[model samples]
Target chain A: MSDIEIKDNPDIKSELQTPPEPGYSEWRKDENTLYNDGLPEEEKDWFCDARPQKARKSVQVIENFLNWARSQSLWILAFGTGCGAIELRPLVTSRYDISRLGMQPRPTPRQANLIMIGGYVSIKTLKRIVRSYEQMQGPKFVVAVCSCAINGGMYWDSYNTVKRIDEYIPVDVYVTGCMPRPEAVLAGFNKLKELIKAGKAEGQNLYIERFDWYKENQKKVIKDWNMPDYNW
Target chain B: METLYKELKQYFDVDEFSVQKASLAFLRVPKSQLVSLLTHMKDIRGYTHLVMVTCVDYLEQDSFLLTYLLHNYSTHCDLGIQVSISRQNPVMDGIHHLWEQGRVYQRELFEMFGIDFPGSPDVHEPMILEGWQGPPPMRRDFDTKAYSEATYSHRPRDHKEPEEYMKQQLYPED
Candidate 1:
């Protein structure tokens, strides 16, 4: 193309930047139609529709529903207080396959639905437990697994452990036994599942009502790590 | 009590001892000799785990009870060693050196019950509280509810209308 002709024809200059339009010549194919040709029928139908459909299914809503369903499947936070926690292994492991019931064990408090207070908790452990409870997200559950959590069992008189865990955080299920058998823990899980199905199992959110309780406990537990420097 | 009976005969100077329950085994030792007994449990009895070390204030008895919950994981035995000390000066030897994890419990006990462990490192610094100068709240003498009430002032429940207050309105009782 001559410089004078290119200067006169703006379309020619634009065509140099992009490939010439397919419809411009008999040799040219339909580019828009060609690009869209590979799309499936359903997607094409969706794109062609003018008015919005009522309550279109979203990836977010689907994911939210899946998460809600999965949350019902409690993930036990591995915060074992004493020997009673040993039985949890059998329930989680091959013997009972607690996973069949959707009760999986998790290491972190953030991911877990249930924080099982196993056996006797020392004031030290109680501090850690309360901190863990605070860290957990909304819709958390507390399962007190032994007589110790209920009444401190054998360590009731000992200055180390609180007789009842209820003094600090709300407990959902109290599984009674000195060292509760694996079957008993499974029963507790079943009970928790029933509660979940019944809509009775909602995440523990007592801190919203009593904010100072957390502050006092945090001061008592996380002494060195204060709120100013630490991430909650 | 078979193990306690045999262990008492083997270790303790006093063979005669009382059994509290089938599960809970307790042995009372002289306050001065508590360290030696703990050391023996650690070295000889293989009760390697120091589950907890706590001080209970027995104000009526005019004494503080120091209890050590020792566990031998191999034998699955829990031992409770108790030593009664005068409440006036609650001092005992620090057992941090015996069990590695005992330092945590010892430090907490020091702060919570105000029990002075002679050789306990880092006992002065607060375990759970920062800038704490008052008597330990866990101590029987320190009433938490009373302390809280004294420390905090309650806000008025009822609100005054700004329009009424702007005029010559007195604070109403009704």
Candidate 2:
């Protein structure tokens, strides 16, 4: 094609490079979304009226020491969905053997208490992750171990990948690196243990409390969700 | 190679045929004559191995060029058959009966290109990318970069030369 031909041709510029369709904005106008759009009239006032009951303080029990013990021995199910998976192999081996710290990789989500989201969690994988997160029993902690889990690292601009794992499930510790070393992963586990000891890592309870919000976010992206609202 | 090309040309009015360096040859066949030609190549020409089934997008022509690559194990020769179909409505004859493994590649092509193989069983099932809502992403018209921008939110970054930043960190004098 000649210079003038190139200048005049609209095909040179892709439809995507151009702005959205002209009537899209006009059609979307006058449409306001309310919080209780689908809810019954009786349940419309529920959100504003709902208030969490204050926790009653109690004396520490002898069984409460299990929290400290549990912190020391964290069973992790590495959801290695991206490049950060390579770093975790060494964590089990001698060089940066995190298994020595009692941080072991478990196969089943049911048997595991801690979940380490290794790098990018795409929209499809996010559903399974949420189900796995919900399957674990109470007193569970999450350590999001990679930059992708934090804010989508390499796939930050990809449509399918989720930006932040924390938005979907409660993340106790965030190990920041494009692909964090096994040493950094150990540090993150150690940090999570510290939070557990201090009684601050209550991600499980938080997840339960904000279940609706998380489910809304999850269902919005994952079309054709045939599973139950909550796995539990 | 000349005998093979001439035989194909004599039987069917092939659009284009060229013998590449070595025992490799390329043939552009119309979609209508694809199955019969492939069957003839496999049965008579001794090109038994159905190597792979793949497609290329011809954006300028507004069509998809589906290629079936075959190999002859005995002679160690390769033959590629190229067939172009409409981009808007891409439906092609399934060569799965010739080679059972062709079904797998056909399924993938269908998943990525939105092409349909009428006789293939795996065409309707899910492939690598499951529950895909967007257009056939491999198409030239499907702008993935734009899709990424629209679907995903990117952080505004203040980028600096990593070398200069490392120089300051390692050698403060520099």
Q: Compare the candidates by lDDT and give the number of the best one.
A: 2
Over 4 Å off, model 2 = A1-64, B1-3, B15-25, B154-174
Clashing pairs in 2: none
B26-138: candidate 1 lDDT, tens digit per residue:
77787777778888888877888888887788989989888898888877878888888987887778887887777778778878877777677787776666545568768
**Alpha-carbon error at A232 in model 1, in Å?**
3.0
Candidate 2 root-mean-square deviation in Å: 9.7
Candidate 2 per-residue C-alpha lDDT over B1-174 given as tens digits, one digit per residue, 9 for 90 to 100: 778888778898686777886779888998899999999999998999998889999999999998898999988999999999998889999988988998898899988888999989868787766567888778878877688766644433335456667888899986
How far off is residue B136 in model 1, in Å? 9.8
Residue B170 lDDT in candidate 1: 57
- Highest TM-score against the true fold, candidate: 2
Displacement of residue B19 (Cα, Å) in model 2 is 5.5
The per-model lDDT (C-alpha) reads 0.64, 0.75
The DockQ score of candidate 1 comes to: 0.03
